[model samples]
Target: MQIATMYFKDRAQLKLQDELLQYNLNKSKGKFVGKRAEAIRELDDFEATRDAAKSIRQRVLDNLDTWLEIFEENARARGTTVLWAETPDEVNRHVLDIAARHGLKKAIKSKSMVSEESALDHAIEAAGMKVVETDLGEYILQINDYEPPSHIIAPALHKSKEEVSALFAKVHGTAPKTGIQELCAEARAVLREHYLTGDLGITGANFLIAETGSVFLVTNEGNATLCTTLPKVHVAITGIEKVVPTLEEASTLLRLLTRSATGQSITNYVDILTGIKGAGEFHGAEHMYVILVDSGRSKVLASEVKEALRCIRCGACMNHCPVYQNIGGHSYGWVYPGPIGSVITPMFIGQEVAADLPNASTLCGSCASVCPVRIPLPELLRKHRETQVRLDLRPVGERLGLRLWTWLASRPALYAWATRLGVRVMKWLGGYEGRIHSLPLASGWTNGRDLPAPAGKTFRELYAARRRAGRQT
Candidate 1:
């Protein structure tokens, strides 16, 4: 909720020192990365499918206005109220207004990143309405002082079974359970009551099908199904970029979405909700609403980083990111985290406040390699760094260091001489062990491990010596 992006360095340092958090992050990385690789390997044509998904996303962005209008028209025809909100406050206002109009007392919610972006739960509680999170992971967070989600797909990835058992024991006033199934059962028992009594259901759409005027919901837990169908009124909120031209396109993307997100060939529940309950229908919402949230998406669409808009929120990039693997998600201090977060967080929030986020990456390119839609994550991060320098958002020392390096890079002789001198100085510092354990300017790197000293000669010197030997031979 709060934009603590400016204190990223401090938070990251604290997270690094947290042993339990590090263990959880490491365990999750192994599960997510290994399963995703296996899932992709089983695909008949993974690259081709990725290409198609990218094309669909780009097409939608290029004609977003037309597709949005078409979606709105079709959704309205199906008796769904379509509302547009340009900001998070507006989104909360719309949800509150709907609740007031319907006299809805209890709201059941599935996991929605867009809603998290809006802090909708806080808004609803402030409005004197009872809001309950139905997703198991979300419920864990809801009771734990409303801690923010650590990962997009697995929100409570940072929490271990022991921690959750303790939390549930305290919150539910029940005996502590160490088994995962028991923990889940406890959560289910608590959430089932809310599901039955809740008058309002709020969810996020995985894909908004323009042709059929349907909102696609994908989940492994089956909670989203109940959230959308059981309540008297259902409200689905998602970014406008989620709209696709047809169910066929949505289907194509779904293949990538499930696998990339949780390594499932298909989720347990996939609901294509069109509108309110029909005359004869018994198991559907009486009233349905779709809120298309802009919230700086238009700015992202028009900016150089528009490729980020193609993100399906599968979170594969974050799953595979080395930086995220180490620091975890909360370090980003926003709804989204990891590589995609580094790119778009600055876009949604101002660059002035979120300038440090873009630098959170190591530019390793692993994120791009695993991205289902082929977003150039490394390039986008570099673009953000460039923007930071241009805006003078970086520290003066960093800017000056880059400038000095650039000036030296332009002069070949001076660059070579400087490298030779630098190597000799490093060799002296390394002493007989040839390991630089501490350095004046690079303590960040040296604080953890030793940096190997440079070899006796620079690359150019070695190359010239080899050429001379060849000529003599």
Candidate 2:
């Protein structure tokens, strides 16, 4: 919600020292990675599906305006109002105006990252209306003073069951329960009332079908179904990039989304909602509205990072990221986290504020390998880094260091001499243990762990000796 990217280094240091957060993150890392591997192993056409999903997203980005107009026409034809907002502020204003026009009071929400991007809950509460979160994870966050989500797919993944038990006990004024089922029951009992009585329901669409003018809602808890069906008015807020050309395309993307996100063949519930309640329909919203928020996405579409628009928010990149695994998502200090966050946060916010995000990665390529849509996350991050350097956004020391490296790198003989001298110096510093425990200028690396010393000889020396031996032989 707030741009705390400037405090990333500080927040990351704090998260690193938090043992409870580390334990929770470690527990989740294996579950998500293992499940996704098993799910991929079971699917014979997983690669093909990934390619199709990438193609589908690229097609939409290439012709976003045309597809958006088609979606609006089709959606409006089905008695749904499609509203466009250029910014997050505009998105909030539109939602507030809708609430005023409909005379709606109590609003129930399912998990919507776009809503988080817009800070919709705060806006609704400030407007003097009650907004309740129905998704269990979101409801937990709402009760906990609305702490931001740690992970996109599993918002409260940072919280252990014991922690949640205590939280529920404190917030609900009930006896503490340790068992998962009991805790869920308590939450359901509390949320069921809000679901039934709320006049306005808000959700985020996983995918939008342009052909059918339908919003595709995918969830494990089925709360989205209730949010859409039980309320007098339904509002779905999502990015403009979510629209697909047809259900067939959406179906292909869905296959990849579920597997990549949670390693499930499918979620517990999938709803293709079209417009309002029909004449014979027993339960549905009287008013259906879809708000497509651009909110810097168009700028991203025009920039070098346009490939990021293909993100299905499956969070495979984040789940597999080593940086995210250790520090958790809150360290990124933005709505999105992990590898994708590193790319897009700077694009959405300015590089001046979020420049450190791009440099957060180790460039290990794990994120790119596991990404369902095959987004070159590492390359995108490098692009951000290049932009930062071009704009002189990096600190003075970093820029000077890069310039020194560049100067040496341009001269082959000097670079070779420098490498040899550097290796020997490092070897001496390593002493008997062959580990550099401390370094003068590189405290960032040594503070966390010791760096292995280089060997006595450089790679060029080793290669030259090998060539000479072969010639003698």
TM-score list, all predictions: 0.96, 0.95
Question: lDDT for each of the candidates?
Answer: 0.93, 0.93
Candidate 2 lDDT by residue in tens digits, 403-464: 99999999999999999999999999999999999997999789889999988799998999
lDDT of 1 by residue, 41-148 (tens): 888999999999999999999999999999999999999999999999999999999999999999999999999988999999999999999988898999998999
In candidate 2, which residue pairs clash? none
Clashing pairs in 1: none
